[model samples]
Target: MKQTTFLLVFGVVLSFCQAQSETGGEETGGEEEHVELFTTPATKMGAATSDFGYNLFRALASRESATNIFLAPITVSAVLTQLSMGGSEQAERQLYRALRYHTLQDPQLHTTLKDLLASVKAPGKGLSTAARIYLARRLRLKQDFFSLVEQQYGVRPKALLGGNRDMKEINDWVSQETGGKVQRFLAKALPRNSAVNTVSAAYFKGKWVTRFSQSGVMENFQVDGGSPVRISMMQQDNYPVKMGADSDLSCTIAQIQMQDDISMFIFLPDDVTSNMTLLEESLTAEFVQDLSMTLLPAQVSLTLPTLKLSYSTDLLPLLNDLGLAEWLETPDLEKISGQAATLSSVNHKVVMETAPEGNQYPSATSTTSHLSYRVDRPFLYLIRDEASGALLFIGRVVNPKDLSI
Candidate 1:
């Protein structure tokens, strides 16, 4: 994936609005914002990215896999943490664990994210993520919680009279924040009178750094059990790629540069006959970073399937299955308002599309192929923000035809 041309996106559109009585507070980006965010060192970026990446996919390990699974862990982390700003005791601990951090005392976690949020906010950065909260009329909001969200996450709660009325606003905001890459934030307006609803959406459109040739050819892709599936394969010869083999994971690991500060890593298992179970177990932020540090550039011929995929799922059940039902309980969020308001629903939608940049490869490298790396089997990919080493999206492509939502 180069510059934003080839997208491997992870987006979560989770809404956490429930029913509540009467109230007062400005409808900011998030109902949870009221104060300024604390600024901390950027050095913690690596640790923060590592923590979130590891905890996120491990949680997905228990998820249903008959279909594609795509997500942005940071979206989930931001939502849970905003809740934690008003959470206490065990409830907060649950969020802490979900975020793959020590306890709530970890300033680096939020601050590191704060910095990343700011970095992406710079002029014209294609990778973007945003969270918005819509609150039911009269619902109370905490000052500290609101301020923390506003300052750290750069979102303000947009207080609304009803969920239905707020749907359009949420959709528009989401679309604008994601550079118009995602617009359908809410299929229909939410039920009227929910206490709180938070929506987080991420969208990406990037170009390839090294353009693949115009002549696209159909190739056989090996699905699990060696079943053959044909897909349009994009090819490039003698391209500079960071390639390596992870014997322990039994997969070919390599980094595909997108542009400056962004890249996609593909983990293609040697044994295409096997399921992704082993590869799933091997994914961790540390392992990915290790590959980044150890892998060296080489002139390689790479063939990867042209990717075009989109998916959506209800995440509450998955969160519950991960043993965090207690964390979503109304009682657990007493600090938010000391009222009976629980998370309503969590929704995630992701879109990924890739193609050659149409820029002709240098004539010199067009013919030479020292090492061949063909992604002709089930494989996992990570779209990362290279500067902070934050994983933007993660998913596996089994059947290219099965990319529908």
Candidate 2:
């Protein structure tokens, strides 16, 4: 099986050192200076959450060698963060470490997360993420925890109605949140004796800045240790892109612009035999942000595969492997309720689709060199938001035919 890693990073090209104040008019030097508070310095929060996402990705990759793994890091992180609000001191500390928030020591972490999520889910971004806490029926939540979660995460906790009914309701809600892209989110009823379950999901369908030609041709894509698979491959002539190479990782990096301050970065290894361990380990929110800034613009003959992929999984095992076994197995959510409450599961799902569509149609153009950028082999790719440097969706395609269905 081919070894590949995929990552989704959001919000690139912003300075995180100085924080942005809320939008308002401030009296300065007897003059009313009005500043639009459209954005906040949530980069620190984004970095912490993305670090957690990468950590989870590495854990999953270590277990599954060739399967396609896709997840929304922000959704998972946000759910965990919200749950921690109702946890005891020990649980809170454990979650903070899992989220890499202890390293930041920022008091306004929750607020920053709220603002970041709001921006990511804002209409017209081409991507959306949401998280919710589903407590077991008859488990009474504390007033403060309920209020804070609703105010910060913007959702009310739901009671698991039990049996097949619970499944239908949750699935319907998930479908509504994802614009009907994920109709059947849950295949079975909620876990028996489950006290709390965290649900997170993301949906994306981006338009390319430079659309690919509709005339795609079936081409051979080499899968490691397996026969080459034929798939529909889209192409564009003289596509404007930001390109770079990492000699240490032995991979070529290319960033293709998209609408709504989003960019897709592809990391294609030099050869099918190239080891992606180093590249995967080196991924961090800050590192990727720097790499995005350093990539130089160039026009290239680009060929990419059309993608429509969906992934859903239980994150309890991965979280356990990450040293949260004690917390997951115990009942220390006293702040949330006086009764014994243990985490039953963490459910996550993601769906992403992209084609040759863009603001304008593809066209032929002159180029300086024969810089052909063909993704005809196993490679890792991620969708990132340039405005805030947040990772949206990340995955690797060993064989395009695997998820095309």
Candidate 3:
């Protein structure tokens, strides 16, 4: 249960970070500025959150018979949006000012990520001291945010917002910002009358560079390790594939090239179940970087399952398993002192899709959206490092029968 909790929280954080990074290139100004106001810093948070987030994503993705799993990336975005919307221009400036300094404290969030990767079963070749230090900096930044949250909202959030009852208002603001995804998680984990406020948000969009033909779509896809569900499976033949030889663990990574150098890496577990622990152990940032460097285009057939899933998670036990027990147990108010508050707990929800839209196509084509990679069975998936093409981490939903509550 502890491990599960750690993994769940980790997944949500990682997903949120990755999704935020996807929008890095967009131009901001006008309505884009408003979204930018919300997205820009959120994207930075992605980089900040990626360290822990990707580690958890990879851990779950490496498991056997994992399928149809969804991880929420909304936590950071929700917090940021909540703060931005509920404050005055002065408050906004102060919040950003605090975040800037806070982020600087950690430098980079990927350090703990690299460390956690080292702890896994098939620990990949280790990272350089520089890389580890860089990641540590990021973790420190996250800690900084924790500190800011506490400082801004503590027992007297009114100091920041001008009243004693601002906590409920902040929570309400969060509920509206996230489209209702995070409010429940907050209500469950936080003290009902506590005046602390936080935010989390996540969004992702991916399209096959070369769209699969609906003419080739098939149904009743056997989702390898679980109950069979009718789904549209996308197939590509003779694509480039990479196979790796490691002691006790043979693995394959399938790259789905998207537009503008973006790609999704599909990691296939060598053994259906037995080697999961080894894969988890072996998964690491260095391994992913190395794997990205080694990929060569090859001719092969790719079959992908199409699915849509949304879910929420409670991550107390998960955070403890991951060595983040202090925040959960002691309520680290010091880190959040600048804001006048403390985080009781962090909760998250995620929604994901592996399907495409039908309206965009010609009327002559089938209206049903056909997406390749029907992940009906348990398998690992990752939105990863493209140039180095390293899979940050992969997630496996082995037992759809078991759900997060």
Q: Estimate each model's TM-score.
A: 0.79, 0.86, 0.52
Q: Write the per-residue lDDT of candidate 1 for residues 1-405, one digit (tens) a residue.
A: 010111111111011101111121122321222111111234244445555755556566556564456776666566666666667787777776666555224545677666676674454334667766555546576666667677777776666756455777777887787777776767887766566666766765556688887436898987775569778888878676766566556677788887556788998877764357766766665456555654555566779888877665556665665557776764366666656677665666666667788334534832565468889887888887666666777876777767742
- Give residue 143's error in model 2 in angstroms: 4.5
Q: 87-196 in candidate 3: lDDT tens per residue?
A: 44544444334223235243332332233222221212111110000011112233444344344422112222323344355445445543443344234333443334
Ranked by lDDT, top first: 2, 1, 3
State model 3's lDDT.
0.38
Candidate 2 displacement at residue 73 in angstroms: 0.8
Instruction: Write down the TM-score for model 1.
Output: 0.79
Candidate number of the best TM-score:
2
RMSD of each: 13.6, 8.6, 15.0
lDDT score, residue 350, model 2? 89
Q: Which regions of candidate 3 fall more than 4 Å away from where they truly are?
A: 1-50, 57-69, 72-198, 215-227, 238-247, 335-342, 356-376, 385-394, 399-405
